[model samples]
Target: MKKENLPPFKITNEILTLIYEIGELIGKISVTQEFEKNLILRRENRIKTIYSSLAIEQNTLTLEQVTDVINGKRVLAPLKDIKEVQNAYEIYERLDELNDNSVKDLLLAHKIMTSELIKENGKFRSKNAGVYQGEKLIHMGSMPAHIPELINNLFLWLKNSKEHPLIKAAVFHYEFEFIHPFQDGNGRIGRLWHTLILSKWKDFFGWLPIESLVQKYQKEYYTAINNSNRDGESTEFILFMLKIINETLIELIENQKMTDKMTDKMTDKNKKRIEVILKYLSQKNYIDNKEAQNLLDVSEATAKRFLNKLVKENILEAVGEYKARKYIKK
Candidate 1:
C-alpha cells in the first residue's frame, strides 16, 4: 500500500508541536533515569496501567484492589472484575513477546484478555456491536462482515506508514477503537496495543501508565474519538493522545524529582518503594520472592532485588538459597 492508502489523518501544526514537546520530554525523562532500570517504578506503572484501563470500563475495583489481585491475593470484588485484572496482568507481563503489527497476535491478546468474560473472546464480532449509554446506542462499530479486512488493512498502514511512531501509535489507537474489532474488551485491548506500539518504539513506554491519564481524562478521550468520528479524520484523536503522552512524560519527570526530594540518600529512595512490604514482613514468619513479587506486582528479578537490598541494609536476613530462598525480618 502507498502513503495514499494511509488512514485519514492530517499532520496539523498542533500535532507537530506536541511531537516536538514529547521528544524533548522523552529526552529529559530518559536522562533523569526515572525508569531506566528501576523495577519498583515499572511495577508501580504496570499497576496504574491495569487499574486505570479497567477503571475506565467501570470495573469499580480500586487501585489497591487491582494491585492485590495481581499479586495473587484475594480481593472482595466482583468475580468478572477480578478476572479482568488477572488477565491484564498476564497480558502486560508478556509485552516482550508480542508483535504489534501481527494481527494474529492481536487476536491472541484479546483471547487472553477476555477469556471466561465474553463469549466473543479471541474473535471479532459476527454481529453488529455498538457503544451504549443506558438503553440508548451511542456509537456503532463497523459492520461485522468487514472487520477481517479492516483490521488487516489498518495493521498494514500502521506497519508501513512514514509517520512518527508516536503519531502512528495514537492514530492506530483511534482507528482501532473506531473499528471496534472485538464485541467486548475493545477499550482495554486498544489501550494495551497502543502502549505495545510505543513500547516497541521505545522500551520505556512498556510501563508508562498512560492509561492512568486516560482514565483521568476519560471524557476527553471519548470526546476526541467522537470528534474524530465526526470529522472522518483522526487528527483530533491524534492531537489528544500526543498531548497525553507529553503530559505523562512530564509527570514521570516531576515524579522522579519528587521521589528524589523525598530522599537524602539512595537507600532512602529504595526504602520508599517497599515501606508496606517491610511492615507486612514484620508480622509474617517469612516472605519469599514469589510472595514479594505478588505483594508488589513486580517481576521475579525485581522482587529479588528488593529482598537482597533489604538484606544488605540489615533490615532483613536472607535464608536458604535458590528456590528455597526466603527473607525474614532482622
Candidate 2:
C-alpha cells in the first residue's frame, strides 16, 4: 500500500510534543555514571523478561520454559513456533554490529534471528496472507504473484520515509505486524525490528525496554493494531506507542531521581548498609532480618525496622513471614 493512499493516519500535536520532550530528557541522561550502568543492566533484564513473557503469552512456550531458556538452562531448538525469546536475545547481543545505516545488516540480523522458523525466516514471506480481525479476515490475500513486490515496496518505504525516525519506526512496526509477512513470529519480529530501528536513531533506545511498557498493556497493544487494520489507518497505534514511550520515560526519570536522592543523602553508615544489601542481592534478590543484622552490624530490631521502613516507602519489597522475611529492591 502506498503511504499517502494507505489511510488518514497522523500523529497528534500533543503526542508529538511529548515525544520531543522525552527525546530531550533522554538525551540529557548521562551514560558514564555507575548508576547508569546499573540502570542499563536493569533495563536489559526487563527487556528480556518482557520479550519472554510476550512469547509465552502467544503460546509459543510457557513462562517457566522461557525463563529456562533465558537462564541458559535450555538450548534453542526448532519447534512448533519460532522461539521469540531467543530471537530477542540474539538481536540485543548483536545490536552493536547492526548500529550502522546499512539495510543489508538489518536484514541479516533479522535472518539470523529467525532462520529456524521458515526458509525465509529473516526475509519476507513470498506467499500471501490476510490480515485478521476476530474470526474475520480483511484485505483478503494479496495476489500470490504480487506478494514479493508488495513486501519489497513496504521495506522500500521503511527505508525511505521522511517521517521522524521514531514515528517512522512505529509506523513500520504496525505495518509489518499487519502484513503478517512471515509464516510465523511476525509479531515478535515486528516489535524487535522496530526497537532496532529506533536504537539506530538514538543510542539510548538500545537500552530502553519499551516492551516492558507494552507488556503492561498488552490488550491495548493488540486492540490498537486490530483497530488500525480495520480502519486502514495506524494513527491509533502510533498514538498508543507514543504514550507508552512517554510513560516509560517518566517512570525511568522518576526512578532515577529517587535513586539519586537516596545516594546523595547516603552517610558512611547508610552507604555501608546499602553496600551490604547490594552484595546480598547480587547473589539473591532477598535478605532477611538475621542476614541484615549480620551484614549491617546492627541489632535485630534495628535491622528489622530499617528494612521494614524501606518496604513501606516503596523502595523495597518484602516477602515471607516476620522472622523469615526477606527484602528486595523495588
Question: How many clashing pairs per prediction, in order?
Answer: 0, 0
In candidate 2 the C-alpha lDDT for residue 65 amounts to 55
Residues 1-330, model 1: lDDT tens digits: 113556888998988898998888887775436566666667878988999999999998987788789778888989999999999999999998999999999999999999899998999999998987789877899899889988999999888888899988988898889888898999999999999999998888998999999999999999999888888889899999988888999988886775555344556546555666754553356899899988877899998998897777666789997999988877
Evaluate residue 75 in candidate 1 and report its C-alpha lDDT on the 0 to 100 scale. Answer: 81
Models, CA RMSD each: 8.7, 4.7
lDDT string for model 2 (226-251, tens) is 78877788888988888888887787
Q: Which stretches of candidate 2 lie over 4 Å from their true place?
A: 3-8, 34-36, 39-43, 46-53, 56-68, 74-83, 99-103, 131-144, 267-286, 289-314, 317-322
TM-scores of all models? 0.80, 0.75
